[model samples]
Each structure stands twice: as structure tokens, then as C-alpha cells.
Target: MKLTDDHLQTFVEQGFVIVEDFYPEERRAQIAEGIRQTLPPWEVIADDPPARRLLTDDFPYADMLFNEFILDWDLIAFVQRVLDTEDIFFRYAHNWARYPDPGAEQPGLHIDNGNNSLLPPTSDRRYGQISTWYFPEAVDENQAPMQIVPKPYGQDLSKRVLLTVPAGTIMIFNTHLWHSATVFKGREGQRYSATRIYGRAD
Candidate 1:
């Protein structure tokens, strides 16, 4: 799981890096299906703030995925190698759900974090936030992948960067940075992805 030198460079220059093989296809499918079972039916509030969920229960594969990603061998190594911190505080995360296209977009654009309170936004950096942008199914131009303003937390935010590497590859990114996944355009089946926020420690 440890990132190679190439991975480190990409993370620094771009402000984010995508690591593959975080979960095998078989495991990814199993975990995605299990998490979906815990979500409410996708038929309400599509016009409002959109429907979202908070994980209050203990599920099997969901927990398994959490363990495998949150401070997994590779994640831990990444934290130590990149941030030079022995440990990172992972702030509690809320589970999220998105239906097909034409839904709400309030939580749209902008990083996973905000700072209307902190004068200089210093408090916002206490915890490093991250999420595994899990794609239960295949993603394409139509499916809409997550748009990450790579390094937006500290660099230029003039334009956003987006990419579709592969399914099951965990996108470990800063929650304090601005990002949003595109909405699916199809009219039938829905795209499913759950973000489990991980707050890096100090």
C-alpha cells in the first residue's frame, strides 16, 4: 500500500494522488453492495439539498473497507512519508449518497471543508480530511467522476482537474480542498458511491 517515490511527487506537485488496487474488484463489489443496503431509497429531496446519510450502524463490509483504507498499511505509510507525522487525527466522517442526474448541488463545488469561523482558517487544518471515492460500478464521461481541484487548499483554483483512472481505486484526498463528483446522465440505473471521511491527526 505504500506509495513509491513517483506517487509522492505526484501528490506534492498536483496536491492529490490516486492509488490503485486499494481494494480488489471482488472486495470492492462486496463492500459497495453492503453499503448500498444501508442507504435510504433514492427517491426523496432530489430537488432540495439532495439526500445524504450518516453512518450510525456497524455493517460488515463497510467496516471492513474502513479498516482497509483508514490507516491501512499503505495509508499509514503515506501519512508518515508525506506529512512527516507519526500519526494523523481522522475526524469523524458522515456517509453520503447521490442519485442520478439533475439532483441538488448545494454541497457541490468547494472543498470537503470550510472556515467561516476561523479568521485565517487555521482551525480547519487541525485535522486532515480524506475519503475513499468508492465507485460501486463503472464510471465514464456519462457517469461523472469526482472533480478535484488538485492542491486547491494551497494553490491556484482557477480551473478544476478531473480524471477516471479505474474503479476500486481509492482517491485519498484532503477534505479541506474543494471537490465534487459529476452527476450521472442516464435515465435508468443510478450511480452509487459512498464517502467515508477520514480526518488526519496532528
Candidate 2:
């Protein structure tokens, strides 16, 4: 679906906006399964601590389903609206699965600039890069919810947003936003999400 003025306003104020059910469940399921299958065998990773992170590099190139999803016109248009540009370049993509790891330390909040972009980040939304995360299944608090700090709130712990959303949920945010991936607290269940990043062509 196209983004509305309210979405723009929210992005301007909070540095991000979450779009629920951006894609159909069936489509998301296919993408999720593709990613899962691309990963190493669960039994192998389950015993290897480092393998539990399950982050893939250049994942879109590994499968046609991922390539199509990244190139979908509707998704591009939605991101265009957020960046206020007609042309944008796909930066990169990766899929990740977070499993329960009570020993895992809380990740630090950081921006996706520097490494994701060649230029320095700007406060202006129009010139900022856009990053999105698509969750194929519901993400509850115990399943490692994403943590975001709104623009106005800065680093205030009280103002942080814990993204506990339903399946097919997509969160679009400025790459300059301060956000972090929380540890999975649940005893069972995995948190799988695909990420895509884009930047203004100019």
C-alpha cells in the first residue's frame, strides 16, 4: 500500500514508521522459508554458538524469491515516498534469524550510516537512507523485539519503542535512526526477519 501523509509526519517526527501487513502472509511465508532453507542445518547451528546469529550476506543474490521481493515496484514506491525521491538505489540486503540465547548481551543502539552509505548521515530526512525489516511471523516481546529511539526522545530509555508486531509487518526507518536488536528472551521459537536498504540516487 502507498504511504499516507500521516506516515510522512510520523517519520519526520519519530525517524521511522511501521507498516503492518505490508505483504500477504503467503508471500511472506515463502520468503521466510526460502531464507530458512538457505541457512545451515538447525541441528548444526544449534550446537555452534556463533552460528546462532544466522545473518546472511548478499542474501538476495542467493535466491530468485529474494531478488523479486527486493525489486517489487510497490515496495520501491513506498520507500520513494519516505525518501521524497523518484530515484533510489538498492544498497544491500540480508536475512537474519535470532534464536533464544540468554547469554547474549544487549546490542548497542547505532545508526546504519557509515558502513551502509558512502557519505555521512544528515539530519534531513530527504537526504537520508531508508532501511526496512520484514517479519514473516509475529514478533512478541520475548522473541527479541526491535528497539528504536524516536528522534525527539534521543537516548531516553523510557521513550524507546519495542517493536512487537504481527506477521508480515514491515518497519521503515531512516538509516540515521538509533535502533538495536534485542536478545531473544523466549525459551522456544525463532525470530526471522529480512532487511533491505536503499539510498537516494542523487
Best-performing candidate as measured by TM-score:
2
Clash totals for all candidate models: 11, 0
Off by over 4 Å in 1: 40-71, 103-108, 115-128, 152-158, 163-165
Cα-based lDDT at residue 118, candidate 2: 73
lDDT of 2 by residue, 1-202 (tens): 6667888788888999999977777787897788778654335476664555545647546688887778877777877887788989999888777777766888898888777887676787888888889888889998889999998877776889999999888898888888898988776677888888888897
Backbone clash pairs in model 2 (N, Cα, C under 3 Å; residues 3+ apart or in different chains), count = 0
**RMSD versus native structure for model 1:** 5.1
The weakest ten consecutive residues by lDDT in model 1 span 115-124
lDDT of 1: 0.55
Scored by lDDT, the top model is 2
lDDT, model 2, position 130: 86
